[model samples]
Target: MSNNHGRVINFGAGPSALPEPVLEEAAKGLFNFQNTGIGIAEISHRSKEFTSFIANLESLIRKQLDVPPTHEILFTQGGGSNQFSAVVLNMLARWRLLHPEAPAEEAVMDYVVTGSWSKKAMEEAKRLGGGRVNAVADSRQFSQTGKAFDNIPSHDAYKFSRDPALIYYCENETVDGVEFSHEESSPAAFPFQLLGQSTEKQLLPLVADYSSSFMCRPIPRLADHAIVYAGAQKNIGPAGLTVIIARKDCLVDVDAAARLGAAPVPIMLSWKTLSDSKSLYNTPSVLSIYMTGLVLERIDSLGGLKYFEDLNRRKASKVYAAVKEGQDRGVFQKKVKDGSESWMNVVFEVFGEGAEKRFLDGAEKKGMKGLKGHRSVGGIRVSLYNAITEEQVDTLVTYMNDFVAEETKPKAEQ
Candidate 1:
């Protein structure tokens, strides 16, 4: 495939690169899906064809992730940002019902603040104005200074409420480039393994925002989560479509919540509305769903998540190797700790004045783009999403090597 989409090597964070074959197939669907003569975008959401298509899309997610039958896959508008509020409102509803006599102000929602995204989610819970949002484990507490969030807190750092409304976290914090341990046996793996240990009762009311990291690898403890939602802009397809895997119990009724002195859940924001209607509660993002469906089909053709897991591990390894080489030359410094490093987003700091600009300029000249870090934490961020092929990563790594060599050479010798 050619670099017609944008730069030769695209490492943008969200609205990131997509597989070429998926793009071509989606382009065809934009004209016509399944040779139906009508474009997928033009089809009615109420029609049997569209219903069946959405059902298949749900099945595809279930198959790939092995989502338990207790969870229901629902599609909705508004990205993961919308779910931040929805989750609080919905889960608070369940909490109120479970403890009818408890004070509304006493209801706590625990959050593990790893990076900007999880922090923002916590802020939104406070903005909702009902329950208390506690920082169960703020990684910033473990940062070198009190400002930066560059590492995952030790398991002992977390203080989840015994009977909280919900516990929230971002699986991969997109902005600060911190991610949970993908290795199951590692001590740095997911911190909530002990939360739902008892098989006698239900799983803890946990919510995860996997907006940027979803589909890149397999999810650990998939069955134990109350809700896991991802915006389609990153690894799957376009924006405007958010895929949600919600447990049936989390889709509580808003009116019932209000009667129990909890905040009213907005109709559109309610997971129950989408789940009850099979995600056709209103006119959905048809084109985005269609494109994502095409992407999932491509994934299945390529041997599902296992193929991507191995490829992503290799890609991240190469990028990290390049970064380590530059670090040894005193030209770069890795942002996150070793085990907490994100496989999907590699972030680091570049040393020397104008060195960052020079690096970006050199990358641009080589047809590599979107390596700039988030505005708040500026340095370099190379997003290795599922669509970013290993070959593209190699091109960037080679350029990185050349950039380091050029920057570190003795000036007087020249």
Candidate 2:
């Protein structure tokens, strides 16, 4: 399964596979970034070369995603887990500034919990204790077993709080293979129209965690969101780089808000701090930013988000088709309901005892790996990120079809 350079087809979820060409270029940049003799890892974050590179990285993202002037892109250290706390702290501060006389108990944070990641985010908000946490929609309640992250609750099921401090949702659930449809007409799509109607003359306090599906496609209603963030490792570069797209209004002075009775936000987690210093308030993830810049450049040359969107759509279609075929043959079972399946991660169960093991072993034998599901939920998961090529997906779908055909054969065929 190894390529000429000894690289195997990697399907790992995070710290996942990157483009081969980018890796090759990055290997050179490690020794001499921008021909400055100084390697990217050892270079100073404040240096002109590094700063310019970071600025260009922001520009690339802006151009590709069509981010408007209302938002600012900032990069930092923490992964999405850290943002769980940051979002609650910062958004609550904004709420406090708007309602100086209101008690913290009076403010509510509405969370739409669809899967593992969104549930974790809601839990973090509760733990932070800045405001009351409410689940606008919990997918578990609508699931078959009465408790499972296996579906996207219909739009009608969501119960949004009027003028909540923040309305949160994860764009894609990598672990549970559940995602809201980008199509507004779909029942599984996020109920955007229902938001902001109750609060007149104010922008919606909307936030989304696009950690796993960032850069895979154009975000729907990008301008309406107050904050959208993602960790780089999933679809862009490596770990350590977290990108935040914050609406200008959301970047409030946290210390000032604290003086007004809002919870004190740590300097590092404050969006205003990161925005003011241009994402270099403190030392940044130099290596990750450098590599990500390279990836963004590659993406631009290949026609940007439109190119990857079409490619990713096709890749997911192939994989899902294989899964459907297997299900029809009684060799596989889909985990997520129709219209909620994630284009990034496809989770399903293989039929028969030892059959799952056999599938894994066979895939490994063919040089494909990282197909195992998340530990909390056991099944097979195939992650189709931007870096995974159509040829590679074809290879996987071929294996899946072969496995189904073999599984359906009579045991006496031997």
- Highest lDDT model number: 2
Candidate 1 accuracy as TM-score: 0.97
Global lDDT scores for all candidate models? 0.88, 0.93
Off by over 4 Å in 2: none
Off by over 4 Å in 1: 1-7, 196-201
In Å, residue 79's CA in model 2 sits off its true spot by: 0.3
Q: Report the C-alpha lDDT of model 2 over 157-262, residue by residue, as the tens digit.
A: 9888888999999999999999989999999999998896645427999999999999999999999999999999989999999999999999999988999989
lDDT against true structure, model 1:
0.88
